[model samples]
Target: MQKYSTILLVGVVVILAATLAGVLVFMKNNPAQERALLPLVEIAPMEPDSAKWGVNFPSQWNSLQKTETNNIDTAYAGSSAFSWLERDPRQVILFAGYPFSKDYNDDRGHMNALEDVRATKRLNLNDEDPKRTPATCYSCKSSNNPGLWEEMGMAEYDAMSFNEMTPNINNAIGCSNCHEAGTMRLIVTNPALNEALEAQGKDWTTFTRQEMRTVVCANCHVEYYFDGPGKYLTFPWTNGTRVDQIISYYEEEGFSDWTYPEAGTPMLKAQHPEYEFFTAGSTHYNAGVSCADCHMPYVRDGAAKYSSHDVHSPLINPEQACGQCHTDVNYVVGRVATIQEQVAVTKIAAEDALIDAINAIQLAAANPNADAALLDQARALHRKAQFMWDFLSAENSTGFHNPEYALKICAEATNLARQAQMLAAQSVNDPSLLTTGTYYTTP
Candidate 1:
């Protein structure tokens, strides 16, 4: 029995020594390797240059650089940066007095933002004019803004002219636009976003990581307008992000982007409202899916998994974008195609109705003997109807973000437009003025 106990003790000692030897070997070989993997360079707070951040995150930076050359075109929208005005000339009539009628193009990728804004034909470069393009125009086009806004405050920053701000803004949209430099956490970088969220009685700082993924996109992808002669950038989200709520906010403010030519109606133009449209009870949004879930899905590198920053249409790479949550990528892609096509058709119908309303309103406004009260009412309806239509039109998704909301907004626009046409005809007491397709028939 003493010899058996001695043998068991020897075996236990051998096992412990072997385990300790293995642990010592691991420590000797791996600590230096792990230290070498640490970030080589530290990032500054709100760093404008994404290249600097690239030292720590090469995969994300490399993918972001690809956005500069992404010229692929989808069935509806992609990174092609095609002319929205040329594709749909009805837009010319819709935005007769606005710069959008002169030069409106589809959106490109983030890397092209500064270049695209500089190249656009819409720039009112005459700093001498009170209506000259304010530096607020550069708000969404550069990564330099977060730093600038911190230094100058958004009010003073927005008060400067676009040309005055030109030399200051060198880089396009980059890491600083959406992230905190040190921690690399998502944040509400834009001051307008901070104020807008606060106005809604919601503290973005208290929001969960999942909510921030969607809210961070709202930094730029929202409906905003210049508040006064100062051209202060402001989001029209005080009342809410819904179409009706947005219109109510605009109505209360008595804001008008421009007066429609011939029609003489005060108009409101929608900037890209993807955040508003998607968060308004979209299925994915309600299901806790964020904008990044599909647009910038997780990708595996050699020894790491990171979210891809190559932002573009999910259709371009549905396998990675849609396949994370959905098993059948093909079916999901088909649904997007179907939803966009349906919305596109409905959008065109709304456009036609608005044009008919504009024709009738113009004729009524031109008539000296028209009923003043009825003519004014017709103009009001046209204003609301066109804004409702433009809300769906200006959004980048082509209605795929929220199909039901898109269709509903378009239907409301069409109905209001038809009512505007009727009121205009009644004001002038002319049945011929209520004709449909006046755009096609007028000349």
Candidate 2:
């Protein structure tokens, strides 16, 4: 009993000494008059400079700068700017007749968003014609975008071409985009997300505090399509968040992004829909895992605990990101790798099937004696197959988010594309073309 009491007394004394030392250091560093003389900053509207915010919240701003690092790597994903086409030539044939065929890179850190977008071949650099892309392209690239949109109303902003808006969108995403000035409370800056929620009878105020962290990111990260008339950014979740449900909604609205130049069939390009997949009854979502919970896990900085501002793949810090729920880190990572491998195999198989279908359709379309009804059926199948394949392709998770659904989608895509190939073979009167699993070289 005496030894225990002595140890407790020593621990209390150590803590008290540390606290006294901290107080003396603070007092010496910041004299009372100097502390009182500090001015209260009045934040102005549309402030895009993150350095200005750094003056008051140095921790967050400094931490956020770490996103500039693109050195980290994982088994399937990393921070490096990798060319998708150079690694997988099959993507070129699959996305033929689309801007993606021109160039698609593996996504990098958010810090590189503006730089990468400016360098991408997807955007036309011709100064004479500034309308290659739309002002909507700046939606996710800059913090100044909200200010630009506010200065020019939605209609005028949406109407302006990409070049017209480029001069104003000078800042990369920063504090102002996701937080209220002075107070620093989280808030949604993107209007399209607000409208999307309202259309579905939901609003931000109705959500819990834990849910808001995820909600803010859902603003720009989800799949979106520009409304054809005004070129306004729109999220297609009115029908539902599932893959097929979104397809149905697009069909109902008669929305087709572009017609394939190879087969003349309308194609819908799926954007990165991470938010939708995460929320669609995933085990983590069911267990109340917020997007920020995994992606922005908390870390200790001296005596302070703050949500990490270095938002990148959670795989980079699985101990803090996944270890809270998962006990075995190796097992979980190995499982994720396994799932990714399976998804990759299935993805390739689906791509091979779709390539064959595209070739068959092109050949059948050229044959004057081909049956028109059979050609139409094959085109419809091509649409379905491409939609299913692209959904998995465009998703950032690869299959880790929902492995079962990912595999199912890929399997169905392969089946549909094979069926289309069979019909195309019949139309072209070539039985040899019906061979399955045979890889065909793209012309």
Candidate 3:
């Protein structure tokens, strides 16, 4: 019994020593390697200089610089900037009373936001018209916005003229905008986004890590309009993110971007509503996919992996962007193209119907014997039709995010405009108003 006990004790001692030795080796080596892997430089809060943050995250910074390239072109639109009006003259007629008609262009990337705004003829910033553009224009253009918002306060900051606030915007969007200093954790920078989320009874901090991945981009990517006496940036999400819900919110607020030149109806201009559109029960979002999942897919660098920040079309890097879930690359690309084509077709059809409605209304306006009630009905229909069409049109995705929703929106626009046309014809006592005419060419 003593011999057996001695043997067991020896075995136990040997096992424990080996385990201890292994643990000691790991403790000595692992922490040093981990420290070495950490960011070399420290980032400061709201750092205006992206270059400083670049030092700590070279791969991400390097990738971000790729946005400067305007070579890539997709099926419907691309990074290469072009006059939106020239691409389709119908847009000019649609935005006839707004500044967008003056100089709207295809958005390139994050790098170009500031540069594009500066170069755009949208704002006549001469001393003659200092209020040509609002300070809110810089909201999405720079990472320096948060600091400016803090210093000037929301009301004062929003009320300042474009020139008065331009000096405060020193840096274009960068790491500081979407990340916390020191920790480098993702965070929501835009206060307006936070307020918007709060209004929906959502606490931004309560969002999971995966949700934050998309929420970071949602800060600037969603549709918004200037509101109140200060022209403060506000999301049209009081009712909901849906087309009709957003329209209802606008109607309740008595919001009008501009009156249609000929139709004389209030208009609702949609900014890019990608986040709202995609996250509103989209297949991708439902499947736990975030914008960063595709737009900023993880890439490996020897012993390290980091989210690539070359944020542009996911189609540009489908293997890394989409291959994780979608097996067939060609099938996915083909599917997106088909969806876009379908949406485009319906969009044009809707626009044609809307233009006819506008023409009919114009005829009614010119006619002395036009019925007031019928004219009012025509005006209301025009507002609804344009709101639907513009919601899809201004969205940067071109209906790839949610094709069914886009098509439905356009279909509703068409139906409403057709109804408006019939009413306008009755108002003006002209059956020709119900038929197709060269409306864009007329005025």
Candidate 4:
């Protein structure tokens, strides 16, 4: 019995030493050498099969699949589709000269990009000048963008027409859109964004992983406009990310996307600025919570761990998302609900103020001798007011991401808008008015 026990002990000691050595080697080699083994694969254009990329990075692909699930809903944004037009028909007058007036729905699943763009009234391919909307429109819609960039170069990618380029943009939003398959690292494939960041004297590559998580969403969720004949994608963050800064930038550039028929203001369209709002909020400001933290919480499947890429409300899985960071689930839920309620109330107030401002502008525009200066004042006020309303509405989770900051920004925006309207009205009432046309009426 003693002889047998001795032999067993010797075998155990040898196994333990070997295991320890193996662990040490793995730790030393993994941070650099192992990462190098993961080569960066440039995905081909219009690679419709997401599963192909899935084989490379199972985790990101698995998370992305959750986007297809339509189970979650919150006060505003969710997995389900919501009609912005039906919610507020006044948008028609606000966006009279834009395609968005005809049809614009709130964002749905990333998977729906191709279908939503196709179905929406924004793109009128049947028109004689289909090129009115350039191929640059597809920049945010799919993984195929990088592939096109590779094949035709950035200049050609921006210059192609939608009708001429639709076939190459068939792939919907997927893994390769945000991740470099070879390295499984996040990459900014949009040349426009790269140039914009560089112009701002910022290196996008230096962004922390947490920042990258939200930056990926910002690639599509921020306010942008096309520049020049190439339809070059551009973010109006030249002046700054703040409302005043962006407005100042546009004014300085003399940029006017369209003129509101009713308001008679050279109006600027505000696209969804989800990342901007979230970044300004308390959670992002204080805790540094990235979008992935709440929107794409982790899920455990057996022994494997993967992020839930549903990209919906954190409320849907509060236990996993909020509860992990917050000890009390009920408190977190209550906070989210309260912030949403406040957002809704503020949204309504801003919308009412905006509509009123629009009405005032239309009335003033009708006078043959209406003051161009006065009209400009009213238009500025309307723009400010509309911007505030759109900012709040665009925030998917209210101030849950940063309650204090979001509330303050919203309040400031609201006050500025109201002030703009008052100034416009004062100008309209003055006798020194010029250049007025027939008053436009809304249906």
Best-matching candidate per lDDT: 1
Query: lDDT per prediction?
Result: 0.91, 0.81, 0.83, 0.69
Q: What TM-score should be assigned to candidate 4? A: 0.84
Write model 1 residue lDDT over 18-102, tens digit each, in one string.
9999988975655332324466799999889999998888888998998999999999999988998899899999999899999
Task: Tell me the tens digit of each residue's lDDT in model 4 across 1-443.
Answer: 99999999999999999999998897664534233345345544435468786665565567777676664667766777777778766566556778888887777788778877777768756525734777777888887777778778877887777777887777788876777655556777777777766777878789998889878777787777787767778887776676567678777877777778866777777777776666653545557787788777777655445677556677777899887688999986887788777866665555555655666666667766666786677677667656656665666555565566566666766665556555555665743322222122222
Cα lDDT of model 2 by residue, 268-378, tens digit: 898888888777777777788888888888776765556788888888899988987899988998888899989988888889999888888888888889888898889
Arranged by TM-score, best first: 1, 3, 2, 4
> Model 1's lDDT to the true fold?
0.91
Error of 1 at 272 (Å): 0.2
Better of 1 and 2 by lDDT: 1
Q: Candidate 3 — which residues are off by over 4 angstroms?
A: 1-39, 126-131, 440-443
Query: What digit string (tens of lDDT, one per residue) describes model 3 on residues 296-371?
Result: 8877666556688889888778899888788998899889888998898888888888888888888887888999
Clashes of each: 0, 0, 0, 9
Task: Tell me the alpha-carbon RMSD of every candidate.
Answer: 4.6, 6.7, 4.0, 5.6
Worst-scoring 10-residue span by lDDT in model 3: 28-37
Model 2, which residues run further than 4 Å from truth? 1-40, 126-131, 437-443
lDDT, candidate 4, equals 0.69
Question: What RMSD does model 4 have?
Answer: 5.6
